[model samples]
Structures are given as structure tokens and as C-alpha cells.
Target chain A: MAWTAPMIDEVTCGMEVNMYFPAED
Target chain B: MTGAAPAAEAPPIDGSARPFLPRGVRLKFCEVRKSWFLLAPERALKLDQTGVAVLQAVDGERDFDAITAHLAAAFNAPHDRIAADAGRFLAALIARRMVETA
Candidate 1:
């Protein structure tokens, strides 16, 4: 079997979780 | 003024070193991609078959030498070549704080 060097790719996802807070009066 | 953080030092990799994935890092298969990924906090690195084979051998019990030996036998490749490649790969991960040696 032919062996190749390990390769890595950075993965990006669009979905993200964020906490929302109301503006303080 | 703020400055860029210093680069992390590369970890020493030798035949005697036993490497393992540290906490917060995981090797998982993605169903959507049908590939393996080295998942870290807020980051994911897609790995090919060769990468998967190398990482799978890192069981924390086998040193670098043994790991290379196993890979060589499995792939019918040269021990020296596998040693060099796997060592470099692991070293890169170590520098990124993805893998640790014990």
C-alpha cells in the first residue's frame, strides 16, 4: 500500500450559539 | 501596546515518546463528510485515511517506535519512512496542543 503524509483541513460552520441580552433601561 | 503571542515551542518527538490525544481533543467520524476529524474546542480538522490510521495507532500505550512498526507491518511500508512522517505529523499536532506525549 502506498502511504501518504497526513493531511488536515480546518472546518468552519456557519451556525453558532450566542446569548442575547436586552438593553438595560 | 499589545503584541502577538509568542509561538508555542514544538514538542520533542522521538522513538521513545508515547503520544496520545489530550483532553478537549477528539477523533470522530463525521457522517455528513464521511471522514475522520480531529475535533478541538471551537475547531475541527478533517483527516484523511492516512491521518486516521496514524492517529488510531496512538493509544498512549505504544511508543513512537512501536507505533511505526505497527504501521509499517500493516501498510507494508518502510519503517523509516513511516517513522519520519508520523513523527512529523504528531509533532505538528503537539505544537497545536492537540496531542500530548507522556
Candidate 2:
């Protein structure tokens, strides 16, 4: 199934995402 | 940007579409098809028949239990692992705004 993914350019294809989770207060 | 963690990578979906369809772990809306689809991205590709099994398992809410069971059975893996993976996908899709929670 093909879909036109709606998102900001940086969040679009081929970008490496780095995530960091902070402590919950 | 302040101290907040960087945004995670996730898929995208229209918020307006949620009411018409309640998505689970594997299913996603196919805007062009006007239908829902099961996404098993290369990150977690299923074997051939498992693909078909995944498709059949997502009919609706009642189908979730069956779907979870099917996933465990098809992958020959532990239930917890299957559950975690499924949860991860669902959470990722939601975070990406690819699927909305209703």
C-alpha cells in the first residue's frame, strides 16, 4: 500500500533520528 | 530547542481519520486506497505467509486478541516479545501522528 506521508521535511525520508528520554517528574 | 529530548522517528497519519477506523499495532490507513493496511516495515519484516496472517488478523477490536495470538503463533516467538514489538510499532505510529488514538 502506497501512502503520501505528511510530515515536515526533516521528519521525512532518509533522516537518521536520535532519541533521548528524560526522567519523569 | 530547550531540554526536551529530540523527537523520535515515527510514521504519519491524518488525525481526522481516526474516528472512522481504530488502528492497532500493524494496521495503517492507506489514504489512496481509502482502506487500512498492515505495515511490516523492513525493520520487522514478516515471512511470506505471516504477511497474509497479519492481514487477516486485523478485522476490528475483537480481532486484536486473535491478532496477538496469531503473531505469537506465526513467529514462533515468545508472547512477550511479540507484545513488545507490537506495542513499539503502535506507539511509534502514534508518536509520528501517523495513527491517532481515539
Candidate 3:
């Protein structure tokens, strides 16, 4: 497939929370 | 971190507009910093050091993978984490219309 710029698509809440859990704790 | 503040929504852009975001990446808004931010419509994200790099790399030419790799090498953080974080941020950005999916 051809290359494309990173467009804001899809939501990953698991990943998001995983990333910020430490900071919050 | 200096004069650079967050980007706010513009009428020129077609997308949702709001102040608070819905992404999972948590952030502490530094009121002292006085930053203005705009999430990509349909996208939600919080900018940390890596997120900032992702933003800088965004010339509408690179994908999330590219940004993740760049940040990985630049910060020496785990590749998996960077990719995951980038994915999450990208999701948020998409939701806000700050970026559009290809």
C-alpha cells in the first residue's frame, strides 16, 4: 500500500489508559 | 514549552469543537503555561514529550508508525509503548478532526 500521513482515526482507550495510569497513580 | 502553545479550533476547519478532550492519554493542563489546544476532530490526545514530537513530525506526510519510530529512537523509550501511545493520540486527534484518516 502507498504511504499516507497519520490521520486521526480509531480510538484505543485501553492503550490510552495504559499510557496514563502511571502518571495518575 | 516556551512561547509555543496548543493549537485551538478554527472555523476554517470542518469538525467538532470543544475545550476538554475524551482520549485516554491523561495530562495536567499547566495553567501557568497558558496553552491553547485543539484536538483533531474525532481525535483525542494529550501531548507529552513524545506527543510533541509526533506533532512536529506531522507535515501530513508521515503516518503514526513513522512518528512512533522517530520518537522511539529520539527518546529511547520502548517501541511498543511509543506505538501504543501514538495510536491512542492519533485516535484522539482523529476524533477532534485535528487530523483526518486516509
Q: How many residue pairs clash (N, CA or C atoms closer than 3 angstroms) in each of the candidate models, in the order given?
A: 0, 2, 20
Better of 2 and 3 by DockQ: 3
Model 2 segments more than 4 A misplaced: A1-25, B1-56
lDDT of candidate 3 at residue B44, scale 0 to 100: 31
Rate residue B3 of model 2 by lDDT: 25
lDDT, candidate 2, residue B88? 43
Estimate the TM-score of every prediction.
0.79, 0.37, 0.45
True contacts kept of 1: 0.57
TM-score of 2: 0.37
Among all candidates shown, the one with the greatest lDDT? 1
Q: Give every collision pair in model 2.
A: B12-B98, B13-B98
lDDT of each: 0.74, 0.36, 0.45
For model 1, the local distance difference test gives 0.74
What DockQ, between 0 and 1, does each candidate earn? 0.28, 0.04, 0.04
iRMS for all predictions? Answer: 9.0, 15.3, 12.4
